[model samples]
Target chain A: MLTTAPTAVGDDAALALWVLHELHYRGFAGVDDGLEWEPTLLQVRGLLEADLERRLRGRWTPPQGLSFVDDALEWIDGQDGVSLARHVHRDADRDQVLDLLRVRSLYHLKESDPVSWLVPRLGVPAKAALMELQFDEYGNGDPNRLHHHLFATGMAAAGLEPSYDAHVDVVPLEVLEQNNTLSLFGLHRRLRGAALGHLAAFEATSSLPSRRMAEGLKRLDLPPEIIAYYAEHVEADAVHEQLAVRTIAAALLDEEPDLEADLWFGAFTCLDLEDRFARRMLDRWGVGEVAA
Target chain B: MSEPGVAFEHPDVVLCPGGPMLLRGRHTVEDADGVPHETTRPVTAVCRCERSASFPWCDGTHKVLPPKLRPA
Candidate 1:
């Protein structure tokens, strides 16, 4: 049944994986939830996930010189990709920014849900630290303050649809791959290391990019509610990055050193997928990379 | 961390190498301008790199700074 489906890391493969993963998140309108557990579908999912994993790992070569933290930071510094946020900040037209926002809403609308799956899978220090980070992602018990809700509100304020998966059809292949990678890591017990690694890398990259996004939104004359979403991230992610890396990721690795490679895999995938997404968007816009 | 039951209590303040100082719990911090910034979240990252556009709080601009310029 899966013979015709592409098994590589390109658009067709990612699209198939995305659809399969979506069943586990919020099923398609006409699709039965039972299909989420159907053997044939699960088989395809496994194959696609394996392909994606192979593709992600193919790009990573373990750093030889620096400490893990320094290596990770240097990994990001060494990445040579277009900065979509910088372009948005300095030159994107209103339509382009809005298009990017629509694509981004695919993930922002469900922020932190994937990583929350790791809370129960962890031990003490990692568990507590992850919870501390998640508590903020969950809005400190205030529904209105929830990060995803914040994104929803921002989407509405910007005159875009805020419903979950509202922009899936409009999102590019890279976005699909990005979301798939996170969901894949979060769903597997064996991949817990990768999940937190992805979390740390994600939080590390978020704060500054969020600031650029906030400025870009402000420049576009978007509503304050929209700006507030990015504004909130600028602070939240700064705290979260430290919590994820120094506290959560470190604690996990200290207990299970065997998972170091997978941890690095997840982090590299996080940066790599984002770079692909940024490059795709910039190429589509025919915009050159802005100075970092 | 492998010691199972050993307590790993959250420190009130964590000095992240080359990054921010994470202050846990509540406190009011005075920035260079002498204005007080209240702790709104359960944990806050105070800008040690001093390049945060948010002033007292980190906005993550430290990542853009040269490694030598980042806080030790």
Candidate 2:
């Protein structure tokens, strides 16, 4: 039987969902893979996902009188959110940057894996577009070019543990919530629209910020590998941003016009989660104002 | 889809207003300085703003430029 939604996705609740979701990915050592479909655990996962969905939707205000596909890029640009990128660009110290890399690894290590779940859920136009974007994300047939591996190599060069889940225990609620949101959108077939929406927002924000991050790494005199990892994003995400917003997202909306609201919700969630994450980190670092 | 049962088809050219012109497939593009840059990725954005730091490839700098200053 499903327990009532936890008052909020507090630490225990978050961890419960995290463990349950991990079953779908790389299951724990000695854990039966069949547990992925266990009724009791799935019920709990369902409840948590419902709660997360409600929380996210409650915060979103879907754009009005506008074509979401045509206007999304400009809409995202107009929003003023606290920027962790700007902080890293100008003032963050070495430890601060390293801390960010560790926290970011929670998502970066599995980069693009969440959205990959949408592949089978889409029609030809959207599916083909998504694959085109994902093909690059997965390194265009070269393991050396794979984004997560690139991050891992960069992390090792920075003297941090590049192993999977090495920093999960230390990440804050904000970080966990961010990862949870990504997984939540991806895992549900019903939320495939939101998944691509998140991808569009993510790619849109990445290119310039990657440039800033690269510059910041240079400022800290960090190793060349670390800087190169970010430098790669500058050009890569520029291409991805266009493909995501124009091709992937546009094609999806074309096929399923009713998904417009869900798309906005997902896009809003992406920016909102990052805003919250940035605020938490900036406050922790005693830096500039966090976006409200 | 580029018609049913068509094994080979997709947009080879896409133009993003106020951004860059997306060129897909294997081709070489020459910068104004007469340097040829090969299109390595499936889709490459050739800078239209003429202000890109990496000539012949967009670095997303057009976003920072004013609407009037961006490509017309």
Candidate 3:
């Protein structure tokens, strides 16, 4: 049955859904591996996914054409709100940086694997562009330099565990949901447009925060290697931002004209969720509480 | 109960309280009854499979287990 609404954040419903989704990626240590394809679990997952999609579509208007990329780029460029990276760069302490790392690790540890699911479903230019971005994310075939590995290294430098799924329990639902959204889009072949849009939005907004994150690490007196991960994003995403928008999103529209709306919906939902996450962090930080 | 925060390279099969079988690979946790539970939850115990030093958890050692006996 389809869900009427999105699962509430941090509730058992969301966590249970997240666990079910996790089965598709990396099954938990002691859980039955066979449950990954259990019909009952898929039924529940479909409901949760539908709910999430309904909420996102309801809240965000998808753009009508390839031109939506231009509008999205403009909107992203015009956003002049308080910056999370700025806080990290200018005033964060060790604990604050660590907290940030912990929250981000929820996504970065797994890196681009979620989005990679869409690769087989995409056509030419878009697929190639995605591979271009993903190659760097995966460290261009160097196991030691993969973004996930770098993220893990950063986590380790901050005294957090580097193992995959190590911090699942501590990450806030918002963080989990952000990653879940991407996974949701990526896993569904029909949502290829949305997946690309999500990546575009992600890349568009990443550079500055990455720089700020690097600055935050430096301000906290962390080692250079710990800061390198963020610093690397500053450069990599700047390039990727262009590829994601023009090549991936635009090219996908060129191939499948009807998908423009889904693309925009994906991009906007990404931005919306990010804004919520950022605002939550800023509000917490404003009140002198740890945002993570 | 197992000590918290210890990393096991491999684990041994351990009987649960009710005689259920548990495979220890990469992460550790008690086998609840006889059913193996896969979770992202931190491993608090080791698996019992001799292949993994992590004990009470599958460190993915089962990946290379002889082609015939591999856990699907």
Candidate 4:
């Protein structure tokens, strides 16, 4: 019997969606794999996804006439929000940084896998451009250099459990929502524009903040592995940002001009979610104005 | 396998306005200091702004530069 939204609404919705999404990624060891396609479970998932999309759409107001693909970087830059990277760079203490890492492991452990789902779904030009960026993200077929593996190695070196989802229990609502948004965009072919838009925003913003993260890790004298992970992103994301905005998103726009609004919506959602996450963390830490 | 009027494609390179030069395929690039760095990825963005902390390889410093100061 399909009941009202599976009784997992409100505060638990994000986590529920995350768990259900995980079934498509890597299901739990004891859980039946078939549950992933269960019509009842999917019905619940549909309700949650619809609710999430509605709420996200409500928060977003489309920007004035402009080209999203070309202006993505500038658009992202115009949004002045709290930056967790800046806080991490100069102020966060060891325990607080550790807490941040624990929450971060929820996403960093998987890295680009969510977006990988879009490979077969994109048009040729967009597909080629995305693969160009994703090739680097996956470390150009070198498993040792694979981004997620790098994060796992760093986590292990830092004395944190490196296993996938090891820190899921400690994650905040902001973290869950942030992650669920990516999976939501990735899993649905209808939201492919949003997925790439999210990718563009993420890459465009990553490089400088990655430098800050590397410096912060250095300041704390944490394990070199962890520092190296952030250092890698400083250069990697620089290249990726270009490929994402100029090539990938641009190509996608050429193929599907109608998706421009969703592209902007996705970019806005990425920045907005990050801002909320930063505010929540700073609030928890009682930190004032982040270092300039 | 030659087509009548088609030209053979070579390795790709793209120059982003006010940004880095995107290079596809592996090659050795000498930095301003004349240090040779081997390309390690399928695609690489070489610094054009000369402001990148990791010179010869862009670390996105161009984005922070003023529009007039950005790479042409």
lDDT by residue for model 2 over A89-154, one digit each (tens)? 888999999999999997888899988888999988889899988998888999998999899999
- Give DockQ per model, in order: 0.69, 0.56, 0.01, 0.49
List ranges where model 3 is wrong by over 4 Å. A1-10, A63-66, A80-82, A286-292, B1-72
TM-score of candidate 1 on Cα atoms, chains taken together? 0.93
Candidate 4 Cα errors over 4 Å, as ranges:
A1-7, B1-11
In model 2, the runs with Cα more than 4 Å from the true position are A6-9, A290-292, B1-9
lDDT by residue (A1-292, candidate 4, tens digit) is 6656666665599899999999999888899999999998898888788888898899999989679866778878778888889988888899989999999999999999999999999876788789988888888889989999999999999999999998989888999988899999999999998888888888888999999998999999999999989999998998898888888887788778898988898889998888888888888888875632
The CA lDDT at A270 in model 3 is: 81
Best by lDDT: 4
Candidates 1 and 2 compared: the better one by DockQ is 1
Better of 2 and 3 by TM-score: 2
Candidate 3 chain A: minimum summed lDDT over ten consecutive residues — where?
A283-292
Q: In order of the candidates, what TM-score does chain B achieve?
A: 0.87, 0.83, 0.30, 0.81
lDDT of 3 by residue, A1-292 (tens): 5344344545566677778888988888999999999887788888788877777788885444437656666556554544667678777666766776777777888888889998888766667657767887788778877888988887787678888877778766677678778879988998988888888878777765776677778877887877988876765665566557755776677778888877777877788887677667766556343322
TM-score of chain A of each: 0.94, 0.96, 0.91, 0.97
lDDT of 4: 0.87
Residue by residue across A1-292, what tens digits does model 1's lDDT show? 7754353557778888988988888788888999999999898898889888888889988766544554565566566655787888778999999999899998898899989878888877788888999999999999999999998998899899989888888889999989999999998989998888788888878788788889998988999998999999999998998887778877787778787778788888898888889888888888876655
